[model samples]
Target chain A: MLRLIGIGLNPKKHMTLEALEKINDSDEIYLELYTSRIVDMTLDELENLINRKITLLDRKTIESEFLVERSRKMKVSLLVPGDPIIATTHIGLVISSIQNNVEYEIINGISVQCVVPSILGLQNYKFGRSVSIPFPEYDYYPESVYNFVLENRKLGLHTLVFLDLRESLEMSALMGIDILLKMESMYRKDAIDKNTIIAVISKAGSEKQRAIADKIERIKERDLGPTPHIMVIIGSLHYMELEALKKLASFPENENINLL
Target chain B: MLRLIGIGLNPKKHMTLEALEKINDSDEIYLELYTSRIVDMTLDELENLINRKITLLDRKTIESEFLVERSRKMKVSLLVPGDPIIATTHIGLVISSIQNNVEYEIINGISVQCVVPSILGLQNYKFGRSVSIPFPEYDYYPESVYNFVLENRKLGLHTLVFLDLRESLEMSALMGIDILLKMESMYRKDAIDKNTIIAVISKAGSEKQRAIADKIERIKERDLGPTPHIMVIIGSLHYMELEALKKLASFPENENINLL
Candidate 1:
C-alpha cells in the first residue's frame, strides 16, 4: 500500500497526529522537496523530530514514477510539504498508483496558497485566477502572468502571484517581488510607484510567518528576511480592506481610498 | 487590545498551540459564529477542551462599533472559525480596530476553503471565482451559481460551491447534492442526472472527515451523513488531475480522459 502524507506548510509541529502516526508506521519514508518546503524545519530537523531517517526524492523521482512503482511491494509514505494534492505533480503520483493497481490514501495538510491569503487579509472568494511567475531565463520573462493580473484587475478581482524556487536552493520572497516589478512595468511607466497595494507573505503556517503589505516600491526596499514568498495584488478594496492595509500594511495617506 | 483568534475549522485540536496559548491568556474570549463554524466540536466541547467559557458574538456585534470600542479597553480575543481573515467581514473588523486605535493581533488557523481543495485533489491555481449556494429560498433557487460554474468551465477552471448552513443547524453532504441538482436543472431540462462528477466533502480538517466523488445523480441517492459540505464542479482536467480524481475521488471511467 502507498500512502501520500502532507507534512504541512511550515514546521514539524504543523503535522496532525494522524499524519505523524502514519509517518511512524511506514516502513520507508520518502520526501519530495521540489514543490514546497518547510521553512521552520530542515530535513535533518524533521528526521530528529519524527525519529525516522527519511530519504529525499528530487523532482525526477517524483515525476518519473521511480518510487511509486516500488511502493506497490512496500508500505511507503511519500511526504509532501503542505497538502499532498495541492500540486498537480502529486496528483500524477496518485494516478500512476491507480494504473499500477496500487492502493493508496491521502493525508491532508495546510497549503501555503490558502495560508498566504488568510495571512494577508484577503477574502478567498474575491480572488481571481492564481498564477505562477517563473524566473527570467536567458533574458526572457513571460508576459502571460502579467496579462493575467491585468485582466483580473480589470474585473475588480485580487490576484495571488506564486514565485518560482529551485529545488536545491532555499525559497525566498524576493523572487515574488521580482515578478511583481516585471508585471508592474507592463502596467505603466509609474506602475511601480506607491499607490499599488502588494502583500509579501513568507513562512506561512509557521508561527514566525510574516505578511507585509505596502507599495510595491517600498516592499522592494524592505528586508523581508525569507524565501518562499507569495505576492498579492489588490485591484479593488472594500472599506475594511483599505483600513487593514493602512493599519497593518502601512498604507500611505493621499493614496486613493475611494476604491469601493 | 483586540485579538483575532482563529478557532480553526474543526474544534479544539485543530487550534494550534499558539492560538490556544493566546486564548488562554486573553481576559475575554468571544466566539463569532456568523462567519464560519467548527464541524467537529460544539461550543460545550470547545469550552471543555479549553477549560474556559466563551461569549458568543452575533453578526450585529461584529458589524457595529460596540465590540470594536469595547475591545480597546480590554484584552479581548474574538474567536472566528477557520482563519480569522478569509472573509471580507473579518477584514472589516481589522480595519475598524485600526480606526479605533485598538492594538490587535491575528492568530491564523486552517480554513475550509483551502482544506477542501487540497482534499479533493483539485489544482488550487486553476480555481476561478468561488460562490456560496444559499439554501433554496422558498423554493426559488438562484441560477447565478450555475452560470458561474458554466463560465468557469468555459475558462477550464474549477468551481468551489460552499453550501449554506443556517445557524444552529447541522449540515450534511445531502444538502450539497440537493443544491447541485438544483444547479444542474438550471443548465439542463432533465431531472439533474447523477452521473456528473461531483465531490461531497464533509468534516474537513477533522480526523474522520469524508470525501467521495461520483455522478451528481448517484451522490444524491447515496446517504452522506452530516453538515458542512462543499461541492466542486470540475471543468477541464489535466492528465494528472484526471488520474487523481479517478484514484482518490473514485470518479467514473466514462468521463473523457484526454484533453484535446
Candidate 2:
C-alpha cells in the first residue's frame, strides 16, 4: 500500500488528524522538500513529532518507480508539504500505482492555494488561474506568466502568483517582482507597472506570516523577511473585499491606492 | 480572542492537530453547518470527538457581531466546515473582530478546492476562477455562471463549479447539471451541451468519496450519493493529465470522448 499524505503549509502544526494517524501506521515513511520548502520545522522535528524515521527522497527517486515497487511489498508513505497532488508528479504516482495494482490512499492536507487567499482576505471565488513565476535564466523567460496575469486581470479576477522553488533554493518575493517588471518591459502590454497595486505574502500559514498590499514601487522597498513568498495581483475588488483587505492585509487606504 | 478553525470536509477526521488543541483550550466552541454540510459524521459524534459542547450558530449569527462580541470577553472558536474564509461572511467576522478590538487567529484546513482538482487528476494551476451554481429561483437565472465557464473554457482552463446549499438543503449533481443545461439553452452557447465532458465528485475527503468523469448525459444519470456535490467543467487536457484522469477518475478512453 502507498499512502500519500499532505502535511499542509506548516510542517509542525498543519497536519490533519487522519494524516498523522496514517503516518504512524505506515511501515516506512519518506518526504520530499524539493517541490516546496517548509522552514517552520526541521526534518528531525518532523520525524520526532510523528515518531517515525523519515527517508528524504529526491525528485529523481520520487519520479522513479522505487516507492511504488516498495509499496507492493510493504506499506510505504510519502509525506508532502501541501495537499498531496498539488504537484502533478504525485498524480503520476497515483496512475502508476493503478497500473501496478498497488492499493493507494490520499490523505488531504492544507494547501497554499486554500490558505493564501483566505489569509489575504480575498474571496476564493474571485481568484483566476494561478501562475508560477520562475527564475529567469540568461536566455529563458516564459511569457505564459505575463499572459496569465493579463487574461485574469482583463476579466477583473485576481491572480495568485506562486514563486518558484528550484533545487532547495526558493525564489524570493523581490525576485518575483523583478521578473514581473521584466515581463512588463518585454511585453509592454500595460498589464503590470510600478504603479500597479499588488500583494506580497511570505511564510503563509505560519506565526510569522506577513501580508501587505501596496503599489509595486512601495512593496519593492518593504522588507518581507523570508523566503517562500507568494504574490497576488489585485483586480476589481468588491467593497466588502476592499474593506477586508484593508483590515486583514494592510492594504493601503482607498485614497492612497486607486483601482479605477 | 477568537479562533476560526477549519474542520475540513469530513467533520470527524479532517481537523489538524493544532486546530484540535486550540479548540480544547477555548472557553467556548461554536459550529455552523448551514454554509456547508458534513455527511461523514453527525453533530453528536463531532461533539464527542472534541469532548466539548458546541453551540450551533446560524448564518445570521455568524454574519452578526455576536461571535466577535462574545470573543471579546472570552476565548471563542468557530468550527467551520472547510477553510474558514472560503465563505466571505467569515471575513466579515474577521473585520468585526478588528473593529471590536478582539484578537483572532485562523487555522487552515483541507478545502474542496485543494482536494477536488487533485482527485480529478487536474492540475491546480490550470484551474480558472471558480463559480457557484445557485439554486435558481423562478426568475433567477445567473448569466455570470455561463460567462465564467465560457471565459475559462476559452482560455483552456478548467472551472470548479460549486453546488448550492440553501436552508440545510444541498444541491445534487443532477440539479447542477440541469441548471447548466438550462443556461446553455437560454444563452445558446456551445460552452455546455449534453455531450460535453465533465467531472462530478461527491463526499470528497471522506471514506465514501466518489469521482467520475464522462459526458454530461452520463454524469447526470449517475447517483453521486448525498449532498455537497462539486462539478468541474473539463478544459484542454495535457497527455499525462488525460492518462491520470482515465486511471484515477475513471475518465473514459480518449477515443470515446472527443476534445475537439
**Residue A14 accuracy (lDDT) in model 2:** 86
Query: Model 1, range B146-211, lDDT digits (tens) per residue?
Result: 666665666667777777767776446576667667667666643235545677776676766777
Instruction: Looking at model 2 chain B, report the run of 10 residues with the lowest lDDT sum.
Output: B251-260
Q: Against the correct fold, how does model 2 do in TM-score? A: 0.97
lDDT of 1 by residue, A42-138 (tens): 7899998788999998787778977677787888999888778777787777767778888887766666766665566666777877888776778
Interface C-alpha RMSD per candidate, 1 decimal: 2.5, 1.0
Clashing pairs in 2: none
lDDT of each: 0.71, 0.84
Q: Fill in the DockQ of model 1.
A: 0.46
Best by DockQ: 2
TM-score of 1: 0.82
* Residue-pair clashes per candidate: 11, 0
lDDT for predicted candidate 2 compared with the true structure: 0.84
